[model samples]
Target chain A: MEEGKGEVKHMLLAKFKEEVSEQQIEDCIKQYANLVNLIPSMKSFRWGRDVSQENLHQGITHVFESTFESTQGVAEYLSHPDHEAYGNILRPLLEKAITVDYHPTPVQL
Target chain B: MEEGKGEVKHMLLAKFKEEVSEQQIEDCIKQYANLVNLIPSMKSFRWGRDVSQENLHQGITHVFESTFESTQGVAEYLSHPDHEAYGNILRPLLEKAITVDYHPTPVQL
Candidate 1:
């Protein structure tokens, strides 16, 4: 890794929305498909998958993945209007929310 | 908040661990009670509460809340031996993992 090369830092927020049907969530997943294309710094993206296969799931709902080239890049991504729009659309439906941030250190290959 | 008092930035990693019994996971919650006592910068902490009273809970397992005064503080907490040890114990059992990070902006209170 170059000594002055920039780093990858990302901040993630997760909220669990209630009373939303699978079809509605699926529709949002599809909506996100279009949203992802608009964000320049969304280096990685994915969603939550069912691990339990049981009919009941309590605390989990949406899972998302994204990456940024620098801390400022993350800031730019977060502050983007479209990104905030996604929040506006999703926030009203959530019952629980959790968030964490990570700065990925480069691995020596 | 002072002009440059510092900021809180935390990275959260969530994974759905499979084949882990509820009792074993509950035991872990007890173990973490001791671990949280060790990390000084952890300003906020809590666990996931069951939103659904149904028989099956598929995606959710453990919910952890932690806080850091600075990014470096978060780094210190993450690299702590106790935290690493927790990872050692829990990694093998995980089936799915999701991670996100957040930087809390100071709000006018």
Candidate 2:
């Protein structure tokens, strides 16, 4: 981790292919979330389906966020064998995947 | 809020226009974060610039996240006068803005 940079978050905005069944998407989500168990460095995970009323999503429909203690930890999770295996099941189903990693800085009042 | 739904999070993926100065972007971020103070229902706010090595951000360079207690709370923040005022400053600086709101569900390991 860079000095003074805190927890890193990996956020994925997924727009699955229209032909991919809902069941397939559910399985993909489960596999993606279960990486927390398979990889020790992944601190936590959460996911959500897009429910925005504003039409500004640009076709991204689901958001998955994973937290890590450091950027190095995130690197580990990204390259872990289990993650690669999960990607095999996930990558084909996605029409587009937008990933962004960042060191979260809280805005205090 | 929906019957079983918990907190709602608003995630924004922003790619600023090339001509927008860094100082202008910083001012926009400060103004966006300060909305937490002006709006009663906005629970918390945080932001980060992308540092992903996988090169899948789809041109989104920054992510800003805001949390609300309920979906209605998010709606209140969306329609709030203060947020609209801030958007006037932020919208023009962006080349693309992807907004997503979701009810966060933790993935228990």
Candidate 3:
């Protein structure tokens, strides 16, 4: 295993407000995608809408995953103006939001 | 946007037993990585240990993310023999487990 290759992954789970239209959610996702391009610390970003209908999710409707070079990189992304703007758009529409950040080490196979 | 390119992403949140050694958890991860290689439906797999110490996770310590071609692909991965074996090993170590599966559409920038 390579040394110091550890990276942080940020996962966000969100449930939208009942009044929020699907179009608005799509627009928010596009805005996030655009924000990723602007944030150098965000190495990658992906978002998805729940389709499994699984009870395990407890009504959480969407998941967003992003990678950063480290925990510091994650903090940088969080403090960036673009991220703040994105949150301003997203927070009002969210009924619930949960976030988890973790450091990933590659598993040897 | 590309037509019919939407993919399913499976996110798993887990907390290990208090008695479970870190080495055992690492071993389970490697086993899972091996299983992903054997399961054709699993396009990608990544796992991480919580580093953020944020209270939002409510003691959840690990996050795993995987991608498949579709929801059907996710089902195939879950039901596959290799996955079952991997779960057999992992379940015993897990104190809590939560999963969410979603379909991700590429956002137009």
Candidate 1 residues A1-109, lDDT tens each?
2112244423223445557776766665555545557788755554443222222233444444354565566667667898789878766766755443334322222
Candidate 3 residue-wise lDDT, B6-82, digit = tens: 58778888889999987787777778778778999998877777766345786788888787888889888888999
Q: What is the lDDT of candidate 3?
A: 0.78
Compose the digit string of candidate 2's lDDT tens values, residues A1-109.
1212869989989999999887787777778888888999999888888988788987988888899998899889889999989888888888988899987777543
TM-score of model 3's chain A, to 2 decimals?
0.86
TM-score of every prediction relative to native: 0.43, 0.92, 0.81
In terms of lDDT, the best-performing candidate is 2
Enumerate residue pairs that collide in model 1.
Answer: A11-B101, A12-B101, A100-B12, A100-B100, A100-B101, A100-B102, A101-B10, A101-B11, A101-B101, A101-B102
**Where is model 3 chain B poorest over a 10-residue stretch in terms of lDDT?**
B1-10
TM-score of chain A of each: 0.69, 0.91, 0.86
Q: Best to worst by TM-score, what's the order?
A: 2, 3, 1
Poorest 10 consecutive residues of model 1 chain A by lDDT?
A49-58
**Top-TM-score candidate index:** 2
* DockQ top scorer: 2
Q: Candidate 3: interface RMSD in Å?
A: 3.5
